[model samples]
Target: MQAGAGQTPARRSRRRSPVPFLIAWIVIIMMGTAGAWLYSEHMKQQITAQIEAQTARQIAAMENNYEQRIKELDAGYSSQIAKLQSEVDSLNELLTFTKDNASNKTDNSNKLYTQLSQVQKQLDELKRKLDMLK
Candidate 1:
């Protein structure tokens, strides 16, 4: 006998089951997946908001540009109309003066009448164009 060997061991080393460790790992992975999904959703929402804001700004800019263009066109048309009316009035005064003088020259009267008719036709055409613009 070697110096009082133990008759029996009080306890033995035991192997632990792997099931708890496996369960813990699975839980951690699931939590990570959920977090990733939430982050992706948040990013998507932010992107959508930015896009909508940009679109709204573009639309507002376009509307403003069109309004400015329309205003410019209106001013131009007004000046043109006033100029045409003045020309017509001046022509009328000239015709009246010529008639009152009555030189009795048939050729000159005929030429003046033809020019007046042509001017009238041009005025009519301009009126039609103005109406179309309106």
Candidate 2:
């Protein structure tokens, strides 16, 4: 009985405190939380960068498509204007010739003059449209 009492006192003096282990665990948990927060922020930045890059690419493609369509329409308008101009010129020449030579053909000369006026009006309208487009 006296020997057991002495062994109990020695064991109590050699025992470790739970306070140091609790502090170590707390430090470890804090470090893990901080690391997770930093990783989350880094991932968010990367995702933002990727989204912005995709948007820029989409914008560029749209701009290119619009530019090409504009060029094609411009070419179509140019050809139409050239053809109309040539028609007006030819009609003018024919109308002048008819006026000078057709002394007894009043009906034919009047028809030719009306047609020339109509063609000239159309040419002027087309020119106005082309200028507005520019």
Candidate 3:
């Protein structure tokens, strides 16, 4: 057969339907979007958990610092109070000693006054005797 005469000319190639390719593309795009959304959600959860853990650690550190500061303040106050009490006790002892000395001085002054009066009366009677004889 002549190469092109006995055969019916090859029918023009049938056009392939575009619908299956379009459907395949749509499915691929949907899967890619879902994958991206899932990845974003996972990253958000990880970030949130890290932030929470960091905040908890900072709060615990602050609390410990505060407690240590309070302890130091308490120790300082207790030391000051003890020092003040010691001073008060010393002053009280000094006051007691001064009071005892003041009372003793009062008693000695009274005795000296009584002796001076008796001596003065005796001298006056001696002068009267001498005048009568003259």
Candidate 4:
């Protein structure tokens, strides 16, 4: 060993034991692995939350579409009901007119028969027209 400035030749310094260093290195590596695992877990949670939010939005949109379709169907039914009611009212009026004329029949039974036959023919024609509409 070489002497430093006017000092006697120095003995070699003792080498540090490797056992403590190895233990420290193992501890550091374990800590790094644990940190990585925790970070991955946190990221997984975030991804799950995002997917759930997207699904909820999709479900809400589908529900809104269903409600809109129901409204359209209800409107169509209401229109059909109104048309049918009008047709029924028209038939009622025709029946009332026929009844009023029949009540004013003359004393001769032949005239009454003729008037009844004509009303029956008119009703048959109206029914045929209604059937065609259907």
Model 1 segments more than 4 A misplaced: 1-14, 92-134
Please give, for residues 8-71, the per-residue lDDT of candidate 4 as tens digits. Answer: 6555567999999999999999999999999999999999999999999999999999878767
Please, what is the whole-model Cα lDDT of each candidate in the order they appear? Answer: 0.78, 0.84, 0.67, 0.70
Clashing pairs in 1: none
Candidate 2, residues 19-123: lDDT per residue as tens digits? Answer: 999999999999999999999999999999999999999999999998888788778878887887888788888877887897788898788788878877887
Cα error, candidate 1, residue 100 (Å): 6.6
Query: Each model's TM-score?
Result: 0.61, 0.64, 0.55, 0.53
Which of the predicted structures, 2 or 3, would earn the higher TM-score when compared with the native?
Answer: 2
Which is the winner by TM-score between candidate 3 and candidate 4?
A: 3
Off by over 4 Å in 2: 1-33, 103-106
Clashes of each: 0, 0, 0, 0
Kindly indicate the candidate among 1 and 2 with the higher TM-score: 2
Show the lowest summed lDDT stretch of 10 residues, model 2. 1-10
Sorted by lDDT, highest first, which candidate order results? 2, 1, 4, 3
**Which residue window of length 10 is worst by lDDT in model 4?**
105-114
